[model samples]
Structure formats: C-alpha cells, structure tokens
Target: MTANTHDRGAPAAPARRSGLGVALFLEATERFSFYGMLSILLVYLLDVRGLAAPRANLFVGSFNALALVSTLLGSRLGGVVLGPARTVLYGCAIQFMALVLLGLSVMWPVLFLPAAAAVAVTNGLTRTNMAVLILRHAGGGRSADGLATLYTFAVNLGAMFSFLLVPWIGRRHGYALAFGACAAGLFMGAAAALLNRRALAGGASGGTARAVPRAVAETGLAIVSYWVVLNFPAGGHWIFWLVTSAIPVFWAWAWRNATPAERPGIAICLILVAEAMFYGMFDEQTTSTFVLYALHDLNRQFSVAGVTLFELDAPQIVAINAGLTMLLGPVFVVLYRLVDARFGTVALSVKYVCGSVFIVIGFLVLCLDTAGGAPGLRAPWGMFGAYAALSVAGLIMNGLGLSVVTTYLPARMRTMSVAVYYISTGLAMYGGSVLANAMGIGRLHAATPIPESLSTFHALFRGFTLLAACGAGGIVLLLPVLRRLERRAG
Candidate 1:
C-alpha cells in the first residue's frame, strides 16, 4: 500500500466542500437504513420469527459482531483494491439487495440468514471507508474535532428519524414494510453515490494495481471466517474471547514496530480504544437489555389532562437516545472548539472521565428506579433519564474516540485502525449479550410477574453500575499516563 492510497493530497476548497457533502449524505442515508432495520430486529425475531429471547439475543449479537469484524476486510478492500468511492457504492448496492431479501424473509423466513450475513459483510465496506473519506475532506487541526462531531451528528440524525418512523411502521403495518423502507433508503443512497461519483472519487487514495490480489484474498478469508462463526454454535463467543485475548499482544507488537513519534499517539489510541470497548458493552444495552426492560417493565403511555396522547413501544424508546444525540452533538462541537481555543487542546482524558461518570450514573438511575417499585409499568422517566445520560456519554467517548484514531494515527493506518476500533465494539456487543443472558433476560416473558423478576433486574443494574464505577477508577489511575502520552505526541 502506497501512502497515496491513504494520504491523498487535499483537493481544492470547492471540491473538498462538495466531497464532504456527498460523504455526509451517504452516511446519513446508510445509517437510516441500517439502524431502522436494527431497532426493530430483536422484536421481529421474537414475535414474527417465534424465536426465544435467548436465541434472538444471540443472533443479534452475532450479527453485530460479524458486521464489525468483517470491516477489516472491507477496509483493506477500500484502501487497496476498490478505493473508497467504489467500495462505498458497492456496499450500498450489497446492502440494498440484502435488505430486499430481509423484507422478503418476513414471508419466506429462510432467507433471513443469508440476507443478514450479506448486510453484515456490507458494513465492512461502508463504515471505515466513509470515515476515511470524511477525514480526507475535512483536513487537519480543529477540523478533526469538527469531523468527529459532524460525523456523529449525521449518524444520529438519520438514526433519530429511523427510530421514530420505522418502529411505528412495523407496529402498524408489518416488519416487512419497515424493512422495505430501509431498502428504499439504501436505494436512494446508491443513486446519490452514482450521481456524485466524481466527488466521491475525490476521496479515494488511488491504490496501486499490485495490492488488488492481496486485498481480494484477505476479503475472501474474512468472508469464510464470518460464515464459520455465524453457523457454528458458540462460535461467536469463541471469536470474541480470542480477539479479546489477542488485543494486548497486537498492541505490544505495534508499539515495538512504531517510531518514537508514533508511539505516543499509538498508546493514546489504544487507551481510548480500551475505554470505548468498556463503554460499548454498556451502550449495547440500549438495544438489548434496555429494550427488554422497556417492553416488559415500563408504562410507555403519555397523557395530558386525563387524555392519552401517544404510547411508545419498546423499539421506539431507542429514539430518545438518538434524539438527545442530535441535540447535544452540536453543543459538544462548540464546547470542544471553545476549550481548544482556551487551553490549546481539549483534554481527551477529561472527556473520558466525564463520560465514565455519566455511564455510572446512567446505570445507577436504573438501579434506583427498579428498586423503587414493582416491575409492572413503572413510569418512563427513569428510562428517559438513563438514555439521556447514555447519549451524552456516547457522544463524549465514541465521538472523541473516532477523532483520536483519524487525528493521531499515520494516514496509512487510519482505515485499519478504525476497523480495529469497531472490532472491539463488536466484541463488546457479544460480551454485553452474554451479560444480558446471564441476567436471564431471555427467560423473561409478558406473563412473568414483576415480583419474580425484581431480583434479576436489580442485580443486573447494580452489576453494571459497579462495572462503570470500576472503569471510571481505571481511567483515573491512567490519567497521568494519558496526559504524558498526549504531550509527547504533540
């Protein structure tokens, strides 16, 4: 891989602006399709497909893991063989086909596996490359911060609308129609990519011909590995454990290979990645544990003056986080810029610490709320507050984490580094699913009495609270080291 493939010279100002717009559009639409399908997927599996909760959760977890792990191949393909623009277009096309099959799966049922696998594989092609394109267009300095904030803003904006609309459609019409909507969104994204091909092409690194065969081989290997993990019982857990154990070894090797100037940045990136992995375990609850809690435990109705306004379904609860993210994302961007102007740079350690606090607080809120009453139809305020806190935490941790990878890593490693970060998240999601299963979330049913489940919910929330508190303590202990590394990197 040549440097040009990863570090293409910045285009002229007008072209740069145009490319950023196209990239952001693609991001927004793609997220709309992805999250729209995801928000309702768990429920669909349980209700439509008639799977038990445990099996459904495992399926969802495995799908997320495969999607992220496959990004390694996708990043290589984009960075070496197809280039970013063509890779993104192909990803959109693949996703479109997969989603159509997913829609049809509502009728055929058997198509779900292959359709889901295709979607998972397509993610590897889109996400990392899109981030690379955004970075290339934005350039450096405060643009790094801006890119992080803006990228998250685009993501949540799409997510917010999807969560609000898709679940409602699924509830009223059917899961099939909702999935069809997602496919249509992908179609629009692909059309946009085609019309703006030149602008999107500007983001490519122009990878050399020599790398194509190697990239293809690696991509094929990833596909086969994903197939094995998806098909084999307990394979996802095995892969998760293997990856978790390998992370430290990989870090050591990279540290030894890095130059003195690169070492500090690499250290900082790894630390941030660790922090993200911890946070991601908690974040996954939004779709898994939290959704289950909302579905079974919360009263989702809204009323004014003794008149019912609207009722929120379990899946609709995810919109709260997305909505909060959209609102707060810009505030963070301004805050980051203001702090950087005053203090030379916003302290990444400070961001992590603050986010860790919110994580602990979010779980604590759930614990107290659960303990306050029987599990039957408690007020939704606790869920709202917890989701709000989590949204802030996510923006602080994940948004900054992405910025750190792009800003600090050598251009050549940016896509792979991003892919690695996502793989950590995939592992976290699988772990979170396991944790949810341990709490007997899969055993829960509508008929299960609140009194019977109280201990389980209480234990789960308390355990998460403790976990978050420990993560916070770890960050505190590492603060001096993180600061020293940041200074050295500068």
Candidate 2:
C-alpha cells in the first residue's frame, strides 16, 4: 500500500468488504500480461528482428507511450460503453489479440508495432477501471484499507508472475512460446471473470455497442496520430517539447479553476511533474535497456540474502527484482513507521527527493561498477544492487503519484492534474527513448559485440547517472520552497 493509505490511521468503522476479489484478480492478471510481454520485448527485438538497439528502444517507447496516454481516453469510455467490468473483459480480449501478434512475430515480422498499439489501448482501458471498481465497493473506512492492501498485493503479484514465468519461458523456450504463455494467462483471467460473473457485476451502466466502437476508434486515431509523428526529424525531441508544453497549460487551467487554497498543491504537482521526467528516464530503462544489458552482459547466476538460486538467464533474472521488492515491501512499511515516529511526518517533497536519491544511487552503482568496459561477466552484484535500489525508487514514486494528487491537489483539480502527470509520463517515455539513443544504448546489443564499444555503453550509464543526479538535485535545491508550498496547500 502507499504511504498515504498506510498513514490513514485506523478505520473509523471496521467492516468487511467483498466482490473486489474479481477486480484484484483482473489487476494481477493485467500486470502479469503487460510486464510479461515487456520482459522479453527488448531481447526479442535485438536477437529476432535484428533491429539496432536504439531503434528497438524507440519502438518500445513510442508504443508504450501510446498505451499510457490512452488510459485517459479509456477511463472516460470504460465507465459507459461496456461498463468497467465488461470494458476490462473487452480489454483483456484485445490484449490477448495483441500478444498473439507479438508471439507470432517470427512468421509475420511486420505486425509488432500494431500489436504494441493494441497492448497500450488494452492497458489504458483496464488499468484505471480495476482501481475504480475497487473504490466503488470500498465505501469507506477499513474497507478503504482493504483497497490499499489489495492494490499493492495485486500489482506485485502480477509483476512477480511476469518476471518469474514469462521471461523464464522466453529464455528456455522461445519468444513465440513465451508470448503464447502470456496470452494463455490473459485468457485464464478472462475465464475467471466470466465464471464469477456475479462478482464482476455492478460497475458503470453499460452503454450502447455504438459507444464502444466510437471510443475504440477515437483511441486508435490518437495512437495513429502519435505514430505518424515518428516520421518527423528529431521526432523524440519535438514530441517531448510538445507534450511538456501542455503541463503548464494544464496547471494554468487547473489553477484558474481551483480555489485559492488549491493553488499551492497545483504548484507542488508541477514541481513533481518536472522532476518526474528524469525519474521516467531511469524507470522506463529498468524494463528496456537494463533488461537488454542483462541479456548481453550481466551474470545471470542469482541469489538473495546469501542463498544461491538457479542459474537463470538474464531475462529470467529480471524476475528476481520483483521478488526482491516483495521481500523489501514489509521492510519499507516498518521503516516508514519508524521514521514517522522518530522524525514526524515525512513531507511528500521529501519522499520525492529521497526517491530521486535512491534512483541516483542505483544508477551510480551500475555506472561505477561498469565504468571501464562492457558489463559482460563483471560487476555482477552492482546490477543486483541497482535493481534493488530502483525497486525502492519505484515504490516511493508510485506512492507519490498515487496518493499525492488525491491527498493534496484539490478535489476539483484532481482528475486533470492526474492526467497532466500521466501525460508527462508519455513525454518522458519519449524523452527516455531519446536518451537511450543519446546514451549510446544503440551500441550495445546481441548477435554482435564490439569489445571497444564498452566505452560507448559506459558513457551511457554515466549519462543516466548524470540525468538522475541533475533531476534529483533540482528537486533538492528547491526542497524548502516546495515544503512550504505543501504546508500552505494543506
């Protein structure tokens, strides 16, 4: 659960909640499907398609951005066209189709991009709906705690499955079979929802079939328009510029619409958004470039807390990060409580700052250990530390994003502000793709390894460290001002 939910104190009235098991099940399954697809994507692109590393990174970024941005459109339509429950059902079906295309890319090399777009739209449709469904039945009080508990558990559960199952299959079997397994997982989720249709009932009133076709069309059009931009020179840069320009505009409109009291929170949101672009650069890499590095370079013999585990392939070892997060989750909870008792309430800005710190440390760990050469069989533990640190960064940032807007931003501006944040993520994803290209990730790949190209990859890691340091430093420099703003906003 997020720090906000954790710190909510005891329930005003204790009561049991049910009917959310189906939503949580869907949540777990959706993440499993999404991350599972991604776990093998970069390696698949490199080894199977013979695409250059930068090109593959751009491919993932462009399509992933579409999916993240589509959630906005999905939220509006999911409530009506099919209702949240049915919308999720439809989305799972769509995702299954996408995965089928992805799984079979060996035969049809041309379908990957289109398949990616479908995946994004599917996530956009279902991601928010799961949480909304949970909230609908949560009512309030301890049931709300139930919501937090379920949300956290379900997310990690899905990631755990993705990291453990999907990549292992891809490493041991083949990409096609691995993707087929993900498809099967999605189908099982759909089947579960169908069998327990009673538990899945009672979402937004289902709208006409016409409504869904239009919604899907509009969303598809958005993706097409976004994809069309790939033709532009300096496409990633211009896209980043254009997307970020919307942030202040959003906050400006929101600020004017909000009460005088809400302005400070909006101000804080803008700061968080700015700093978050850097966070995106690293966070997105955990999926793309990092996984690729592991595949080509890092040692895959795995262990945790001195217990040796199996000698998994690099892609398979990515699951270990998910496992590590599960192990550390409780440690963080207890640490948060202790810190709260010892130092008083931790400010949201502080959380972001600290998150940035952890992230930078993670990057530095990797950069320092890999300074002189390609990572091949060198600095094995550093990547593991990097993964662990990044996982913590993920939790802190997730908490900040999930709770900050609702807890701080005025209710009137919450939705739009949240949209601004997510839209920035799309921009940042593009920016990250740009950086991946910039950082010489293009030089590192499978099927060929230039020993001298180690310099290029090392520069890339240093760039990551520098980007994270600068972003976090900016947040730190302005830390006092943001804290005051938070107090005033509250």
Candidate 3:
C-alpha cells in the first residue's frame, strides 16, 4: 500500500484506556512471531535454501537495515494519511501479509529475502507507531518506567512463546509448518489491533496532521548522522560480546540538562546509536553467531514438559534466550523500580552502566564456557547467560532510556525523535552483520581449518570487548558535547 493521502485532521484527545490490555496482548504476540522467524532466518537460508552461511548473514543484515529505514517512511505515512490508529492498522496488515509471505518462502524456498524484508518493515513500523501511542499517553519518571515495563513485557512474552512454539513446530513438523504457525499468530495480532481502533489513534489529540517538511527534514538529517556513527561501534560489538553498548545510553542521559532547541535531536541520536549497539550485540548473540555456534559446537536437545522430544538443533536452541526474556521482563521491571527508589533520581547514565555490566558478565561467562573447558563446550548453555544479559539490558534501555528520551523531547518532535533513534539501530544491525560475515570469511566459516582450539572465538570476543570499551569511553567524552547542546537549547 502507498502512503495515505487523507486530509490532515486534528487528533482525538485520549479519554479512556480501554484497550491497553488488548493492545499490549497483541503487541506481545506480534513480537513473538517476528523474533521467532528472525532467530531462525540464517539457518533457514543456509540449511533450507542452500545459501552459504556468509551470504545468508548478509541478506539478513541487509533486511534489518531496510526495515529500520522503513520506519521513517511508515511514520510519515501514518501522519499524512491514516492518522495514528489507521497507521497502526496498516502496520498490522503489513505484518500479517509479511508473515504469510514468510510461510510461503519456507514452502517454496525462493521468497526468502523478499519475505524477510517485508517482515522487517512490518516490525519497524509497528514498533515506532506503538511507541508513539504510548508516549502520547504518558510521561515523567515513573510513567516512563511503567510504559517501558508494559512494552518490554509484551515483547518478551512474544519472544518466550516463539522460543517454545517454534522449536516444537520445527522439530516435529518442519520449517514450513513452523513459519505457517507464526503467520497465523500475526493475523491474530492484527485482528486484535483492529478491534481497538479508537485508543490507538486517540493520540492525534486536537492537533491536525500537518506535514512539517522542515521538521521532518531536520529530524531525518540528525537520524542519518546518528545512524552512521552508531553503526560502526555497533557492527564491531555485535560480532562478539566483549563490549557493551552502555555509552550511547549514557550520552542520551547527558542531554537531560541541554537546551530544548537541540535536546530532542541530540538525545534521539545518542539513544538510537546506543540502542543500535545494544540490539546489534543482543541479536547477533541470539540469532546469527550464537545459532552457528550451537549447531557446530553444542549438543542440542528438545526437552518439552519434562519429556525430551529430541536433540534440538542450533536454530531452535536460540529460542531459549527469547523464552527466558519473555518470562523475566516483568520481574526485571519490579526490580528496576525498587532499585530506582534507592538510587533516588536514577539517571539514564546509571541504568546504561548497569546494563552494560550485565552484558560484560554474560560474555565473561561465555568466555569461560569456551576457554575454561566447561562441559557442553560443543553445546554450551552459555546462551542462557546471554539471554539473561539481554533481558537486563532491555529493561534498562527500553524501560528506562526510552522514557527519558521521549519526555525530554518537545511534543511536535517526539515521533520524529523516536523514529530517529530507531533508524540508528537499524543501520547498526545491518552494518554489524556485514562486518561479522566479513570477519568470518577466513576465520570461522566451514572451509577454514577448524581453529585448533577455542582460540578463534576468544579472539572474536576480545575484539568485541575492546570495541564496547571504546564505545563506552566515547559516551564519556561526548557527555560535554551533549550537555553543551542541551544547555544551548535550554
């Protein structure tokens, strides 16, 4: 569908919170479908389609970048044509269609890249639109925490469901059936969003949906810059988890005291850059690199309801990480709240640093699993540790950072700001994948003489650790610039 061409109209003021439960429910389900498919895409390409692992990785990376770019287009379309509710509906419809196409790709096997791209765009749009809705309804410290919890809960629940469901389906039936099930879930989510139309679009308030070309252009430029800078560190970090994406988060926090004129753009840039690094690291660990590790090195198993169904493969094992997060997001939220109370204001910098520490520890354990001769060295349970880190980081960044960034921006620029942050991550995700593939060329692939030991993987980890440390340092250095910008805006 093309961008909406409806007359610009004022948004309806939010009067009720009726369908929030349903909305959150649908969001969770959709997230499950998206990530479930994502966790398995590289395997699908390599195992099912006969594509080389490196090529498959690049395809997935390209898809991620495109999807991130689509969010900008989706937000613009939402503003001009369908308004907020309709925009969300459009994204849902796209998601449904994408899922169906993905199922077909599994069945026919030629539609992989196209199907993947469609799904990516759907996810990007849905995330941005849903976020806009939540931001419109809430603000302030606790409110931000609440919204982040709700958002994280929904996503983690979806991830949790996918981890269990996809493994069972793919193991018992096949890839095609597994993808088809995901498509059905997507349709269900779309249906739920359609039922709650009013609440979704109520954020339009009284302000008409005027296309502010200058504002859009300015926001777009800032996003492009943020993405370019953000992706370099993110790409390096994603290949290995030695480093943390915490610096970007701290940089965003540093903007709290900046001038209004500049705060939104600068904050958005830093948040997106940081988040891009965070997600790049998280996704690569669970999806691409980790999946390969499990298949090649680990003893895979499928234990369902206390019964061991079969030895699950690498792609399926990745679901464990998603599942754990789905189960733990709410618990983390409660913990965050308690911690925030003790820490007083609980600045973004604090959360960023804490989250990065989790990542560092997770990787440290993984390093031990690889180098310390841990049991299951071939089929390490280190992934469970990786998931734990992802959950903690998600709570801090998605829960805490988003709230700060959204509240810190002016209303007129909020959506654009969110979009900017999103696109930055998109670039980081794609770039990181590309770099990983390149790094693996003569290093980790099937052809390379199996490294004599775990030394190769250790080297990868050390490289990433150095990158993360550098990015974190950059955050410190950039603090003055962010503060200066924010003060000027004020």
Winning candidate number (TM-score): 1
**What would the per-residue lDDT of candidate 1 be over residues 1-490, giving only the tens digit for each residue?**
1122344467777777788888888998999999998889899988987877677778788878778877776777887687887778877887898899989999998787677777888888888888877777554343676788888988898899899889999999998999999989878877987899888777546566676567556655665566566666356777887877876776787788788888888888898888988888898888888887887778887665767777788999999999999899999889888886888666777788999999999999999888855546677888889999999999998887777787667765677788888888888888888888886776776577776566567778888999899999999899999989878987
lDDT of 1: 0.81
By TM-score, the better pick of 1 and 2 is 1
- How do all models score by TM-score? 0.93, 0.85, 0.77
Compare candidates 1 and 3 on TM-score and give the better one. Answer: 1
In terms of lDDT, which candidate is strongest?
1
Candidate 2 lDDT, tens digit per residue, 41-70? 777877887877777788778666666666
Q: Stretches of candidate 3 above 4 Å error?
A: 1-16, 139-142, 203-282, 301-312, 339-343, 372-376, 398-401, 446-453, 473-490
TM-score of 3: 0.77
Q: List, residue by residue over 1-490, the lDDT tens digit for candidate 3.
A: 0001111342433343544565677777778788778766776777776766666666666556556656666666555544555556666676676677777776665565456656666665677777766645453233565666677778778877786677578767888778877878878877776776665556453224454444345334533543443334234334223112433443455466455565555653464356445645545545676666665555565345666666656666665666666567777667767876786444455456666656566666555566654433444446566667766666665555456555455455456556656666666666667656555522555543334325555555555556656655655555566555444534
